[model samples]
Every structure is written in C-alpha cells, then in structure tokens.
Target: MNHDGLRFGNLDYMQIAWSEVTPGEVHASWSGHLTACGESVIKAKPVYDSRVRDITCAECGATAVFDLGTAREKAKAITEKYEATGSLSRADAVSLRETALQTIAPQAFKARRAGDSWNAISSNYLMSTGAATETDGTSILVGRVGLAVIEGLEVSEYQGGY
Candidate 1:
C-alpha cells in the first residue's frame, strides 16, 4: 500500500542511527543495510509520516540510521595516526572498528608479525573487549600499534604487537 505518497511495497528500509559529532553534520549508520546501501553512502527516503519519518527497515514495522560517512573519515584519521606514531589509544581502536564496520573494511585484524611488514595477521575479533583483564590478561581493546586484540590471550603472551 502507499502511505503519504511513498510506497512500502519494495520493503527496503534505510533504518539508521548517528551521533552529532558537531552540529550541521551527522555520522549515520543503516544498521548494516540500507535501501540504496553502498559501501560509501547511505540514502533515506522520507515516508512523510509523522509517526515514522523514515522506514529504513520494515522490521515488522520499525526502523533507524548511522553515521558511516563521518565514521569512515574518523577511521582514516585513526589509521593515519597509527601509521605516523605507531600508537593508538584504546579509544582510537574502538573508533576504527566502528568505522571499519560501517565502511565494510576488515574490522577484525591482528598486529603484523613484529617485522617490517604492515600487513595485519587475522585474529578472532569475536571476543568481547571486557573479557581480558590486567591481572588475568589484557583487554583486547588495548590500544597498540596494530589495533591489538585477542581471544583468551594469556597475560604471558601479551608481548603486545597486534
């Protein structure tokens, strides 16, 4: 059926969410999918409904958005920082992961084997950041040169490259 001159027959929702890093701009995300979902941009069509402004995803009738644009830019800055200083704060790593997910880049990566190579070794990013501890182990969220993260990585193995 048609609602307010917008058709819902296609069932493509641009559901998204974002935060105001600054005013007059927004960093948006389409949950993981969007109507015109592209690796670079997101598009939200107005349904003209006061109750539900944008039908990004028809989740039995629910929706939202995210800031992939701002996110990618932030990720780039973080990557650049890591490259220049070979160091990233825990916050930077988290930002990278967030943008990487939005940009469709490799979100899960390990430090390159301690050598001349910049290539990151693939590691398990499925683990929670909180799982690791200072005494028992380090948090995979440890800000390192390689966005270092691990699953059950013992404190002893924490020489810390990736």
Candidate 2:
C-alpha cells in the first residue's frame, strides 16, 4: 500500500485510521497524551518489558500503550468488563486506557528500537523520530498507528491487518 507519509511530534501515542473507501482521504487519530490522561506514554524494548510496564507503573512508567497486539486485546477486555457491569464511569474508562497504554509502551519501544522498520514506497519518503533516548515524560516513542475506516467512532474497516 502507498501512504502519504505521517508524522507525530510531542505525541506519546497515536491511533490512525481511514474514514472511508477513499484510502487516506479520510483520516482520524486519537492521542495517547491526551486520551484519558495527560501523561505521555513510553515505547520501550522487548515484549516482556512492555508487558511489565503496561501492567504496573513501577515497570513501565507509562499511563498508556500502543501497537502491542496483546495489550490491545487486554484493553478491549477491560472495556468489556466496564460495559458488562453497567457501571461505566470516567474513572473506569481512564483506568482501562491507562493500563493498556502502560502495558504496550515497552513493546512499542522495543519495536521501534529493534525489529520494527519503516518501508516507504514513494521516493520522497522521509521517516523521522521525535522521541528522546531517556526514560522520562518529556519524551516517548510514537504509539500504535493503525489504518482503518471508521464511522461514528466505530471501526468499520481495519486496514492495519495487525
């Protein structure tokens, strides 16, 4: 697939998707830094480390996650739990997103630092990173970015394919 190139700076995390059949014409994104909490998320190395971080702050120091498949599933489960109980609240939602964010940071970090690589089909491609090398809120790896077509905030077509 061909992409027009996307960039995120000062973005702890981002979720991207297409809005219609027009490919990239209709795009949408949600920020990790501003989602449920104001904290910036970290992308770290190794799945184990990422999982640890997402499960607890002592391990990850982040409040949200991105790109980790397992973490995403867990986040969904958390949301389901909230809905099932009919006790959904702002705090509950925040807590679920926070847990998922923290849990996936390490995996995202590892992906960016290790096995993950960017492939641009166009000649004018310019992939860049605005993250810091240190572990602090001042910096963070870009979180999970997926391509999907959504309608009314509900996923209609997911192009990320995992």
Candidate 3:
C-alpha cells in the first residue's frame, strides 16, 4: 500500500514577532508553514527609505524625480555540516539558517534538507546614512531577517558539502 498521500498528522510551523529596534527600523513576523505551504506570503512592511534628500521645484513646489538605485542587494549563501558518521543532520540546517540570516535584508536566502527547506519570502533591507527633509526628518527603515525559525527537518542520512 502506498502511504505517500496519507496525512501524517503533523504540521511544521514557525513565527517571528514585531519589535522596535530603532526609530527608523521595526521588526515583525507572521506564522510560516513548511509541510503544507512551500512558501509563506508575507506582506513586506515598509523598509528603509534609501533616500538622502527630497527634491522639489522652488518655483511652484512641484514634485521632482531623482535616481534611486536598487533599494537592496541580493545576498545569499549556503553551508552544510555533517556528523561524525558522515550523515546529514538538522544541525547543519540550523547553522545554515544562522549564516543566511546575517544582514538586515535577505532577498535570496535558502536552506534545504531532505524533506524541508527554509527560504526568505521577501526583501529585507537595511538603512544607511542619507539625506532627509525638514518635515519627515531622518526616519529610516530596514527589513526583517526571519521570524522565530525552527531547525527541525528530516533529512537523509548522507552528508554532503553545502
């Protein structure tokens, strides 16, 4: 009998919460599903305003346009470790996750195991020193790394370089 379609009666879930790091940066998270949903649809909250100054027309106060390059860069890396017996384990995934969630933004970060993979849903960026307006002030915004992530995945018993 094929037991592949049967529901194993367990679901993997993880979540990160909202917190204020600085005036310009706020951290928040939502529940993530692995077994059922391959990826979580997380609405990206406002990240850093990568602008130094706002340009307006002095003659009539009309809106001006400026070249704003890419808000964030794509950063990704993968690492794998093995046990003494040369078997893939959850620890490797944990280490990879930690390494992946390094910067403030994770546009392309992913870690996979035998049956599960952790991927960054959206762009998470950081704020650098830039210009500001008199009214808006210097309210910068950054992105979220990940929520309360878990590293419990069932992988094969074979170790390989990540």
Best prediction by TM-score = 1
The alpha-carbon lDDT assigned to residue 36 of candidate 1 equals 26
Q: Global lDDT of each model? A: 0.29, 0.29, 0.21
lDDT value for candidate 1?
0.29
lDDT of 3: 0.21
TM-score per candidate, chains pooled: 0.27, 0.25, 0.19
Sorted by TM-score (best first), the order is 1, 2, 3
Candidate 1 lDDT at 97 equals 51
> Which lDDT tens digits does candidate 1 get at residues 20-102?
22222222233333222222223322333112222222221211212233333444544565546656655765665553343
Instruction: Write candidate 2's Cα lDDT for 20-111 as tens digits.
Output: 22322212233322212223333223322222222322112121222233334444554555557765665765554554345334333344
lDDT of 1 at 29: 31
Name the TM-score of candidate 2: 0.25
